[model samples]
Target: MEKKVIGRRERITLPEWGLKMVTAKVDTGAYTSSIHCTYTEEREVDGVMTLFYRVLSPDNKKYKDKIIATSNYTQKKVKNSFGQAEVRYKVSTKVIMFEEEFDAEFTLTDRSKMRNAILIGRKMIQGKFLVDVAEVNLSLKSKK
Candidate 1:
């Protein structure tokens, strides 16, 4: 299989959450992908424990103020930038990049201080893409 080339940074979409053109940084050093979440909570919905979370802040006019709820989530111990172990919520969502759709798992975390809201890790790009550090937005450019 020929792997597509992606840049160090690319635009992606989460169709299930109504998000488009979200900037995501490629981090080959990390194992699991992560997304910035405003907040996350566990509540009983329709008699089932559900995980609800919101992504991006209201300032991001294009996609904001939306809550995504699902029982299909898990918690895992992930290392932070400081290399400290922290348990974070992980969920699967449909990610669209370079016009290709695929299911990818993203860990929910408070990345308000980070430059980009999304971080695409090795796991998500492993078998599908090759990263070019000097390039950026290769996915979006491919459409032009």
Candidate 2:
């Protein structure tokens, strides 16, 4: 397999969830990737616990204010940027990388104050991409 090279920041899409051109920051320090989420609601749908949440804030230009649902998900304790451990929802989804699709696990958290809407951690980048410190948006460039 050919190694795909990406930059420090890349634009990724979650096509299955109707999201496009979502900005994601590549972080080698993080163990797992995460998506900015808010207004999370949990309800029993047909006797099964389901979660509904929105990705990114509505004020963001690419924001859709979409209410995404997931039946197969988990709540795990993860350390935040402040080094404080908190429980967050983990969901599996397909992410578009180098214009190819791959399965990725994302933890949902309220990143309203963060610069990027999504974060691609070390697990997602391992052996799949080479990072160039001087570059950004390599995925968007490849799409053209």
Candidate 3:
């Protein structure tokens, strides 16, 4: 069987997070993908540290549906667009693109200030997609 190739900007459904249709910006420049989250909390379970967070969609409504994920690792001094360095937490999850699912790492951050909540970076798109800057959602149409 041949693997299906995904496009730059695609509509994705995060069922675990209760996100029906989310528009993600496929950025090859970013090493790790990121999602907009709010009310993030770090907790310990049986001596293992775990993270729980809520993803905020572009609609300005908080997806109270919490996702419990384990910390893959921590990154330090990540430079942002404004040249500001900040530390962020990284987590792993399965993302479905073009009806295909794959495990990918995502950095958790409050991206409410940004335009889109989810950003699909190069790490997640490698060998799976090709970006067309002029086109958006060329793969799947958003149900929202």
**C-alpha lDDT of all candidate models, in order:** 0.92, 0.87, 0.71
List candidate 1 segments past 4 Å from native. none
- Report lDDT (Cα) of residue 49, candidate 2: 98
Q: Compared with the true structure, what per-residue lDDT tens digits does model 2 show for residues 45-137? A: 999999998877877655556788989899989999999999999998998877789989899998888998799998888878888868999
Measured on C-alpha atoms, candidate 3 has an lDDT of 0.71
The count of residue-pair clashes in candidate 2 stands at 0
Estimate the TM-score of every prediction.
Answer: 0.95, 0.92, 0.80
**Cα RMSDs, all models:** 1.1, 1.5, 3.3
lDDT against true structure, model 2 = 0.87
Clashes of 3: 0
Any residue pairs clashing in model 2, and if so which? none
RMSD of 2: 1.5
Look at candidate 2 and tell me the lDDT of residue 95.
89
Candidate 2's error at 103, in angstroms? 0.9
Better of 2 and 3 by lDDT: 2
lDDT string for model 3 (1-144, tens) is: 454455556787766556666888887888788888775678887888777666674355455555556655555456665678788777777777777777887787888788777888888877777676777776564323
